[model samples]
Target: METKARLVAAAREPLWERGYAATSPRAVLDATGAGQGSMYHHFRGKEDLARAAVDLNTDEMRAQVDTDLGGPGPALDRLHRYLRRERDVLRGCRFGGLAQDPEAMASPVLAPRVEEMFRWPVGRLAPVVREAQAACELRPGLDADRLAVAIAAGVQGGYVLARATRDPTVFDSAVDGIVALLDTARTEP
Candidate 1:
């Protein structure tokens, strides 16, 4: 890859795994075998590179979610697929994990992007939930927006739980638990 692309790609893993505070420009340069000059050429600084890396991560995640929720099926099934989709549970969520980083969340550039990472999913899921409610798959009178937020919360919370307990199953249980709660909302037997 080119020097700029290499810097961004290298920055992504460390940013996700180590967060903004821990990931330094030198670390990125070391990872990419690019010189300080090359990095400076491509980015204003660590913050600029971090912004690029975060945006890339967010875009990729959003597309995956859109695919998962947009798949062919009953709306609930689509939601389930998203919840159960393959994830690096032990590594935690790239977007949600950033929320735990004081440095990342404090960044004027990163703060809103991280917030959108959480907010966008809730927005994406709300319509599908409404679709399920309309089709009688989910019980009536439930608030679609709130339910969407809950689902988003469940997934993020699951990551924290699993990380805290040092057990991936804790994550599975959280997600499965959300699915079960949703099932209880089914209009059908």
Candidate 2:
């Protein structure tokens, strides 16, 4: 990997583990084995490095989700595929879990990228919902945009619940419940 990319990748694990407040520039540098001059050469400071890492995570997430969402299947099928896809259930969604940390939400530079990472998936899913409604697979009254938002929230919340309780079953239950709700809602009446 490139030096900058290495820095970002190294930074990602610490940030995910310790979050914004606890993850210091020195920690990231030490983790990456990059000195101050090397880091400064690539990024302005910790915030800049965090933003780059956040963007990298966002892009990776978007690609993974888009692939699932656009896969060969019905919208709900694709949704289920994405929902139940193998994940580091223990670590949780990297970006999603970080957003809940007090420091992450407070950092002006870091917070927006984190928020955008979430908002992108919901935005992309909304269109699939509308298409499902148009095809008469979903109720005409179903609110695609809002439902997308709720589903997105459920996903993040599922990870949070799973991590807090250290139980994968909780995450599975949340996904199953949401999928059931969406399936039922999408069925032809």
Candidate 3:
């Protein structure tokens, strides 16, 4: 890839894995095998490069969510697809992991992106939930927005649980719990 693309790509893993506080610009440069001059030529500094990397990660994640939730199926099934979608459970979420990093959350550049990362998924999921409710697949009394937030939270929390326990099954169990809850919420046919 091009130098700028390479830098952003290389920065993403460290930023996700190490957080903004620990991921030095030099580490990114070393990973990309690019000189300091190339980094300077492409980005204003570490925060700027981090912003680009975060933006890329956000875009990729949003696209995947859109695909998973927008696919042809019942809204409930789509939601299940989203929850059970393949993920690197042990590695945790890129944006959710960054939110735990104080420096990342405090950065002007990173903060808004992180906030959007959380908000956007909820926004995307809410309508699908509402649709399920409309079709009588879910309880009519259910709060779509809150359920959407819970779904998003379950995935993020699952990642944390999995990472904390060093067991990917923890993540699966969390998802299964959410699935069971959803099934319980379904209207009796």
lDDT of each: 0.91, 0.83, 0.94
Model 1 segments more than 4 A misplaced? none
Residue pairs with backbone atoms closer than 3 Å in model 1 (clashes): none
Q: Candidate 1 on 1-189: residue-level lDDT in tens? A: 899999999999888788889998888899889999998888889999999998889889989999999989999999999999989988899976678899989999999999988899999999999999999999989999999999999999999898888899999999999999999999976
Candidate 1 is scored at a TM of 0.97
Give a tens-digit lDDT track for model 2, residues 1-189: 777988999888877777777778887778778888999999988888888888888888888998988878777677788888887776888786567787788888888888888888999989888877777777879889999998888888888898899998888899999988987897656
Candidate 3 residues 1-189, lDDT tens each? 999999999999988888889999998899889999999999999999999999899889989999999999999999999999999998889987789899989888899999999999999999999999999999999999999999999999999999999999999999999999999999999
Q: Which candidate is the best by TM-score?
A: 3
lDDT, residue 184, candidate 2 = 83
Residue 129 accuracy (lDDT) in model 2: 83
Which runs of model 2 end up more than 4 angstroms from their true locations? none
* Residue 158, model 2, lDDT: 86
TM-score of each: 0.97, 0.92, 0.98
Candidate 1 lowest-lDDT run of ten: 89-98
